[model samples]
Structure formats: C-alpha cells, structure tokens
Target: MKKETLFIAFSTQKGGMGKTALTVLMASQLHYTKGYHIGIVDCDYPQHSIGEMRKRDTDLVMKDEYFKLQAYRQFSTLGIKAYPIKECTADKAIDMAEELMQTSDKDFDIIFFDLPGTLNSPGVILTLASMDYVFTPVSADRVVLESTLQYATMLNDNLIVPQKGNLKGLYLFWNMVDGREKTPLYKAYEKVIAELRLNMLKTILPDSKRFRREVSDQRKSVFRSTLLPADKTLLKGSNIEELANEICQTIKLENHGNQ
Candidate 1:
C-alpha cells in the first residue's frame, strides 16, 4: 500500500504569534522524538525564516564542538539525517512539496509549510486551501484574537464550507499563555470561540523565553533548531510535546516511527 502524507501549516494573519517557532518545534519534536519523517516548506518568502535558521544552525553546528558532537551522535543513533527544509513562494508551495515527496529517498509522514503572515499576499490563500490541516496559533490579546477569529471564520466560511480545496480541518490553539493573566479572560474567549463553532486544541502552550532561544555555540543544549530536535530537558513544561501528540492524534496519523 502507498503511504499517506499529511500537509499541515501553522498560520495566522498577524505576526509574532509564534507560528514559525511552533512550526520548527513541532517538526523537530515529531521527527526526532516520535521517529516520524518531517519536511518543512518555507513559503514565508524573502525572509524564509526557517530556511535561514537552518543555514545558521548548519554554521553553528560546524563550528561549535558541543552542537557538532550532538548532531553526530543523533544521526548515528537515529540512522537518519535531519529533516529537509525547502524554500519557495506560496503559490508554488504545493508543487514543491509534491516534488520533494517524489524525489526524497524516504517517505515523509508530514510536510509543514511556514507561510507568510498576511493573506493579502498572492497564493497565500491557495497554499492554505491546499493544506490537509491548518493550525492557527492565537493569544489572549484583543487585536490578535479578533484578527484570528475573523481570518479563521473567513476560511471556514469561504474555502472550507465550499469544499474548494484539500483543506480538511482548521483548528485554533492557544499559544504564549501568561499564567499571570486572569483566567476569566481565557474563559470568555473560549465561550466566544465555542459559540463561533471553531475547533480548538486542548493543549495550551505557555509563555516561555525558551521559545526565542535557538541554536547557538554559547548554549549547551538547543531549544529550537531546524537541524536538531529540542533537548528533552529543555522541553519540559513547554507543552510542546503534548501539542505534537495532540495534533497527530487529531489528524489520526498512524504512528510509523522507526523506534
């Protein structure tokens, strides 16, 4: 039987919601920890943040003895190199991914797209419409919440309802949660979201400076890297692991990890 691959994206209209960070984190976690094959399409063109980060990670791993040794040990143990990250425009993202699937030596279990922040960009909507699932990272802020709800509603109503594309599910997850903030605010948002009939992941990621930390010679262990899975110790309390598991289960992905 032919293997099935799911195309997913972490997207939202507004920036600074940890979309790219979560994309890398989840891809790394699922690939390294859960033993899944993952690929990333950096469709957030121009900056291509994920692609640039992969380049910087390559440089740091080459120069830093700690990261270099870590990479070597991981590859030797896993018997696989780091997952691939491809860069392209939004419009060509689907075609690019299909090409990768055909050309790659190993079959990918999931292909994630890191998309541009604005929907106004050409092909952004098309790219999103093609995804099997789109998980939007949202916060408790008023402006961000409003924008996210509107964006999700538009997609749900226009593309999803009309069955225009391959999109199967649209989910919203709470990211960067500040414990100090009042609980009532979140409850209110939950009420509104429930009334709006939006699907939400049960896992809520906490606000942590670690999310901003990337591969560096100065650090002993990496928190985020396109080439390396996050250190298990660093992942504690971040809820990233839970989030990954939740997404996989929600998508009903069969666990095909080599482990």
Candidate 2:
C-alpha cells in the first residue's frame, strides 16, 4: 500500500480568529513533541502570514547565535527535520498538496493548510473540499460566532453532505477562551454550540498576549519557539499538546474505521 498522509486545514470565512497561529502551534507541537514529519502550505492569498512567519523564523535563527544554537539543539535532540512552507495560491493548493505528498523529499506524514479567511477567494472551495479534515477556530463574540456558523453551513451544503466523501470531517474549536471559570460569553458559546450542533474539539486555547503578539514582532510560536522552550513563557501558555494528542487519536480512529 502507498504511504498515508493526514491533510488538515485551519480555515474559516472570518478573519482575526487566530487560524494561522493555531496552525503553527499544532504543527510545532506535532513536529517537535510527537516527531511527526510535517509541512505547511500558506494558502492565504495576498497575505501569507505563515510563510512570512517562517521566513522571520529562519532569519532569526541564522542571525542570532543563541537562537541558532538552541534551535540546532532542539531539532537534533528531537530528531525533527525542518519542514518547508510552500506559498500556494488557492487555485494551485490541491495540486501543491498532491505534489508534496507524492514527490517531496521530506515525505511529510502530515500537511497543514492555512487558507484565506474568506469564502470568495479563487479555488478556496475546491482546495478545502479536498482536505481530510478542516478545523475552524471560533471565538465567543457574536460576529465571529455568526460567521462561523454560516461558514460551516456553507461547507456542509456545498461540499460535505452533497459530495458525500469529499471532506471527511469539519470541526470547530473554541479559541481565545477567557478562563476556567464560566462567563457570559462561555454560556453564549455553549448555547451557540447547541444550536448549531458544532463538532467542537475538547481542547480550548486561552487568550494570551503572547499569541497575539507572536507573529509580527517575535515571529515565534509558544510551543516550538527556538527562543523559548516549552517550559518558559510569560503568557498563559498554549494547550497545543492536548490539542495535538486529541487530533492524533481522532485521526487514528478514523483511519481504523476506514480500513
């Protein structure tokens, strides 16, 4: 049998939902912690945030001796390879994924796509529909909630239900959660979840100043930053380990059933 690769996308029709951050966090955790071979496709047209961040990361690693040393140690110790970030337009995304899976020397075991935060982007639908799973980050705010629900409904109507097996799963996870204590927004989120019957992941990431400022200035992720290890951080910290584990288990279960 041919090798199997898990294709996942962090996408939504709404912006400012931390889609790129979540994608980087999950990819970092899986690659550094779980030792999975992975690559990211930055498909957000006009503004490839992940690709830009990767470039910044590379520049930092090369420019700073301390970061270079620490990064080398981290990668060598974990036996993890540097994965490529491919900049793809929406029209070429599916083809790019196929090429990566079939021909890329890395032979990535998992591929993550950071798609445009809109529905009208060219080939967005085609690219998203080809993925094995699409996870949308949703906030408790009313505008975000409404857009997320509408986006999910659109996917279901246009691709999932109508095409049957085109998209394996569509998942939603609460992002930027406030705290452990139940708040009004939390309650509203619960109500929305019930109303839309959202298939939400159990792992919810908390709001953190670190995540908010990570991309532009620091260009580092909390989970897999060369500047800081997993143990050290000022922010509330990321729960990406739990999220990664849950996703892995789910994927395994799905693959087993398919067999």
Candidate 3:
C-alpha cells in the first residue's frame, strides 16, 4: 500500500519573499508534470494570492504551454479540490485538515498549504507541526535572510515537537534576484548565511521582467502574452521557470531519502 503524506506548508515570518508564488509553482509542478494527486489549502484569507491566482492563473498557464499541458484542460486538473479556508488558530486549521482527509483526498500523495506571512496566526504552530517540511523563501538581502533565521529559532523554541514526526530545514533560496553586480544587500547576506551556516538551495531565481509582469499585469507567464508593451517591457530576461524546476527536483530528491 502507498503511504499517505498529508501536506507541507510554505511560510516565512516576513512578507515580499515569494511565498505564494513558490507555493503555486510547486502545486502546478506536482499536478501537471510529476502526476501526483495534490491539494492546496489557502490559509491566506481575504486576499489569498493562491486563491486569486488560481482564479486567474489561466492566462499565465496558457503562456507556458508545458505547464499548461500538465494542468490539462480539466477544470481544476491541478487536483486541488478545496476552497480557501479562513482561520487563524491551529485547532481550526487542523480540524479543517482532518475534515479534508475524510473527503476524496484519500488517494492524494501530497497537499500544499499556502500560509500567510504572519507569526501570530493560530495555525502557524500546528501547521508547522503537521508538515513533512517547511520550505522558506528568502531574498538576497541581509534583512530577509536574518528574518528567516529568526523564524527558524521560533520554530525551535515555541513549537511543540510532534512525537511521531519532525520538521527539518529545506534551505533558503534567493528569489527576485537581479543578474547585475552583487548589491550590497547580497554581500551582507552572504556573511550572515556563512555565520549561521543555514542550508541554502542551489537554485536562485534571477530578477526578471517576466516575473514582475506575471504578477503585476496578471499575465499567466512570461512566455505567453499578446500585449506588445507587456511582452516587450515585462519579459526581458532569462526565464525563472528553470529555478522552479530545481525546486521540484529538490522536493523529489528530499522525499526519496525518506523511503
């Protein structure tokens, strides 16, 4: 029998670090390419990017035909069948997770939870405890990596360790990186990562217009667009899809070690 793996939550104590984007990217990957049964729990209420993007991600999807093919033509072929849940407490979130487990997700191989960027949320601790791993996205800035480190400390200090499971560092990756000369922020961050010796992902998403346009103008992807201004001004650089692909590889390789 195939063992059940419930979910993994992507979180960071700070905002503007690409948490939602990565969460959506991973869900897209697991469903479209890897052929895993997947579900997404969008805990970012009111203005949930995951839900908003899901509602409008079709344009971008069409642009990136490869990923689009993975999503296929089905309505919600990504396999995420639930609507966004609004709650702050761990008890509430866990209760929702338990309820979801009773539904059609019995065959699901993975579930992705897109969490809001807040430490005080009621589900923060419970969500962290329930996950197989928490993938934190960090920017190439001293402040962002420092904030990431601080949250790691909080997980160590505040969270009640689950007797039957454990959470481990998945490493921080630099997102929205510009391919120009290293900014002072990058230099400062290097020293901090060296001192803490925190694990960092090998992939770095270069700062590019494609990402900005995809988010800003509601374009589905950098590769797919008809607007001349958006096409010319928005996607002028190397694609970041490759970096997201590495994240997929990391997810597979990491889980491979468990078996």
Q: Model 1: runs farther than 4 Å from truth? A: none
* Candidate 1 per-residue C-alpha lDDT over 71-133 given as tens digits, one digit per residue, 9 for 90 to 100: 999999777689999999999999999999999988889999999999988899999989999
State model 3's lDDT: 0.57
lDDT (C-alpha, whole model) for all candidates: 0.92, 0.73, 0.57
- Going through the candidates in order, what is the number of backbone clashes in each? 0, 0, 7
lDDT of 2 by residue, 1-259 (tens): 4457777998888888888877887776666656667778888888888888777777877887666776788767754556667888988987888887777765566789888887788988888888888888888878888889889877866778777546877888888888765777676776767676557788887877566454223444444342233433532356766777788876762332111
- lDDT-best of 1 and 3: 1
Candidate 3: tens digits of C-alpha lDDT, residues 1-259: 6556546776788887767766655554445444555566777765766555655555655676654654454335434333223333443555666566567635555667777678677656667777766777677566776788888656644442334344644456677777785667666776676676556676666765444334324333333221111223332343334554565566563242112
* Model 2 residue-pair collision total: 0
**Which window of 10 residues has the lowest lDDT sum in candidate 2?**
226-235
Please tell me which predicted candidate would have the highest lDDT against the true structure: 1
TM-score of 2: 0.85
Residue pairs that clash (backbone atoms under 3 angstroms), model 3? 59-220, 60-220, 60-221, 88-122, 89-122, 90-122, 177-207
User: What are the candidates' C-alpha RMSDs?
Assistant: 0.9, 4.1, 6.5
TM-score of each: 0.98, 0.85, 0.69
